[model samples]
Target: MTGETIGSDSADDNDDTLAAAGEFAVIDRLVAGRTQADAVTLGPGDDAAVVTAADGRTVVSTDMLVQDRHFRLDWSTPHDIGRKAIAQNAADIEAMGGRPTAFVVAFGAPSDTSVSVAASVTDGLWDEARQLGASIAGGDLVSAPLWVISVTVLGDLGGREPVRRSGARAGDTVAVAGELGRSAAGYALLHRGIEGQAGFSELRQRHLTPQPPYGQGACAADAGATAMTDVSDGLLADLGHIATASGVGIDVDRRLLDGDRQAVAEAAAAVGADPWEWVLGGGEDHALAATFPGALPPGWRAVGRVLDGPPTVLVDGGAWAGNAGWQSFD
Candidate 1:
């Protein structure tokens, strides 16, 4: 009972690790003073939270980020990691043409982790959730050897059907709602230990925390998108999924992606890597890539076209012979 309190007003700063603060106190600190969105009828402090799904249907998705695998503590602050976790999960909901309503996070970190650090992470979770007009309804904290953050997001489809990967037809246009290759460019910069340049600094920050094109999924759906997905895996690899599912070929025009390539050209030069590789193969950008039947929606740029062929993703009608994407085992 003589442990350090975990709330924001706690006086003790030193020796304020999770073990020192205890579980219930830390949970209280994470939930304290937090406001839930209107969809969340009941929030933290109960066995479970209650969220409303107005359309009599709910879209749900889950993602897990492990330390060193999905993120690095040395490169990303606890706050950045929290934001990344929420953004990626929210992107999944967006891919389904839904708006995220609530999130339940389950976090595990070493007992020696500082309570202040945990609070910062929670703050980041709340911050990013607010961008989607959502809230963190509830979550769990547990002791582990390394950091593991898992998030489950509940989304509303707004009476629209969820866009499926199998819906892309041969003639549909492939459009993207957000920038690509920045995260990969940032990763290359971080990997090469290159810093100090103002532009490179921006790329590095992007690697730590992604800026997902929020609200575009619904827009794409409203614009008659036939198939949709988020660019979490490299663009080519993710598009390959739609190709495989829809039994169509995707031909990406490199010319159409020049802007993305140019955005990272300088950083690529500094790191001695090809900007095209990152633009085509880099992952974690979380940009929304959808196939539309007609003109693209606002904020979307045409990048490719669905083709009538075998299930494959082609760059300029040829296969790309570079590292195409992230693999959990590799």
Candidate 2:
């Protein structure tokens, strides 16, 4: 998830600031001309919104982003921040083998911020939601020192059991859906101020807004996924959670991930960094990783195998000595 805080200088005198528009007017602009998903029974304009849970249960998750902490306005636009906020939260639903149905967002920015910027953010939220056949049921706009966004996602399992992170067995194959290392590599490029490369811009955009494999979570579930999670953190760190939960060890073959390394090898070279580190330890790709007992499904490739041993993630049969993933504090 991500948030924003911006300077008022970006807004022209003709623009209506948040304080000038007032909270109600600003919120009206945010929710105007929006369509609700089928799951949403009632949308904004009421005291509360309602969404239907067809399977008799609802899957819910929430995440937040802060200025300078989760995002930098100078690097990303309000629209990018909005898309990222929705994508990351939706990933949590997908990781659990559910379909995202609706989202409720809360945004906080300086009173002097432009309403157009806020509307741009809402446009981003709705555009991304439309891709998954979801809706932005409702949200709140508030005054704050910086841009901060918090999103809550509601999902449906469609009568199937939810896939968790604790069902791996000794012989299960570990597989991943979607490409890896792109976002991390993008971050590296942006951080180092590298530009004008053929592929570096795409990498930087990936860092601004991730592209999670949307429907692969349900496909993995149907294909008999025993355990699952989205790779928001580094691959090794995320799999380590599965290892601990399932009481099994995971061994990844570096050769299996060479393709991902190659994808970012040029950018890594430009920055004088190791592409393998990004492939193994880079996080925020939002890719799906799961353990399956049967043939891998389409769009998923096997990267390793479950082992009968102490719970841990090993690289090429040994421990990894480099950074394993992102840490909120550090």
Candidate 3:
């Protein structure tokens, strides 16, 4: 896409090709001069970049978004897809109670695709990176049958120990920060073609670009959080990760989440869907959910408490009966 003019003479247009310019040149153009956060020690251009953890430990995670499986060209522009991809990946690092520092993206699409669209996607990636004081340190591009985006993010512990799912003691309180069920609500709004619904715009936008509680991950880590994870696999299923990992039980009080339920209630009614499903069964919200030993950090709201039972997540002291969570094969 580079070196070609808007209506450059045919000679110039014909001269540009992936094979001629090479992958390195394209990647250089994409990554050159971008800034990395303080947390990154070795960013891009290496086998794997090293991220500094205050406690000398790192938190890393990866996510892949396949065309139509995670997004649609009709519903989301390439830019939205790119931002969503990074946001989700960053959320994974945050789930461990760490601050996102850098991202590496691998992009695949048809060769005939406009270089401009690819640039647009990179623009979106950088846009989101700017929000977190992070950088797109490296990336890969190749020809594929459809658009496939994979992102891996590295995070810093900020001197605090990494928060794992296995640390929640029985008495730790469960809490969350950031909006829940909005992405689920947005998906419903889009699928049902519901229009002009009050406060639905934010929900719809959430599906396009999730608002991950950007800096809260570090806050959770600093606040003596026993365990933490982002809400990407629905509230209960994500909690299940902590439960299974820690060999402990979690009980979520439904009453504490009524505010979230109320927030999405109107959109649920418009589509004849259960608000609780959107709230409890929803994923992709990227909200921070953690277990704390005492008062929650400034921004978190208490939702429940850790229990002594077997590894499981319960709502209102019981199992939830709706959809469990999302899986690639399902």
Candidate 4:
């Protein structure tokens, strides 16, 4: 925490809510003593913050998280929510083969929320941003019936052409970086109310804070990735996007995915669910999956290959018959 008083000049600093302390006072507490990344020329306090785009090309993406819909306050602390917000947005830049440099966040909560709670969320956002050598440049705070966080990320592509979903081609290798299905396994464990095992505990924690493969996006670009995307929506669903966009088919070898299935097999049995479903259909892992010509990159593992046939995803050369991925309205 920043350890800054809510209203240092007022006697109610220790007990003030956002309403009691007022907007400016609470904002001061949230931004107090936080350091900005080198790319952020001017941060929080003016009409808007200035950020450097040294590559002359900036990649930007935004996402919003709603209370009880995207996250449950009882299950996720303000800190976890904040980290999650930053991670997901950063992953978008990474998928484009760019490096994140700055972020802008907007937060909304009830007026009765404690100033300390807001500070805790700020701390989480900063903690996650620091991991990528980025900064929270600016943001807005407002009153709402429940918590809502919206984040916009700024990235630099280092003069490299962006990796896009439409670039995959037949004869290219489909590979992935970082863990798969772990977050879904953790969500299952949490949803089923199972706890106690050390392994299970770790999985549960991953569901709250995903560990996306940072810096690997630029690595994939440098290694000549033809197409890339983060596994936010299940592997099959996400790869299907690439397939459709590239007008090609993707055939995933089940044997290649045994590791991910094995990782969650025990949890699946405990929850009375199929491990393959989590491996093939679970989303929110935020891992990077890409198609590359020639050899794979250092951090990527071959999972499948692009095909000359129809625009669809097939597992073990056939269609999968389970939940393909997550849909907002489903």
- Model 1 per-residue lDDT tens digits across residues 165-255: 9999999999999989999999999988998579899988888899989999999999999999999989999999999999999999999
- As a TM-score, model 3 comes out at 0.88
Q: Which parts of model 1 have CA positions greater than 4 angstroms off?
A: 1-15
Give candidate 4 misplaced runs (Cα > 4 Å): 1-13
The candidate maximizing lDDT is: 1
Worst 10 residues of 1 by lDDT: 1-10
Worst 10 residues of 2 by lDDT: 1-10
Better by TM-score, candidate 4 or 2? 2
Flag clash pairs in model 4: none
The Cα error of candidate 3 at residue 43, in Å, is 6.3
**lDDT by residue (tens digit), candidate 2, 1-330:** 222324455545566888989999888878877878999999999988999999999999999999888888889988999999999999999999999999999998888778888888899899899999999998888988888999999999988899999999999999999878999999889888999577899989998999999999999988899999999988999999999999999999889999999999999999999998899999888999999999999999999999997999999999999889988887
Query: What tens-digit string does per-residue lDDT give for candidate 4 at 69-164?
Result: 787776787789899999999999999999999999999888877787788789999999999999999999998878889999999999999999
Which portions of model 2 miss their true places by more than 4 Å? 1-13
| TM-scores, one per candidate | 0.96, 0.96, 0.88, 0.95
Candidate 4: residue 136 Cα off by (Å): 0.2
Q: Kindly give the stretch of ten consecutive residues in candidate 3 with the minimal lDDT sum.
A: 1-10
lDDT score of residue 94 within candidate 1: 93
Sort by lDDT, top down from the best? 1, 2, 4, 3
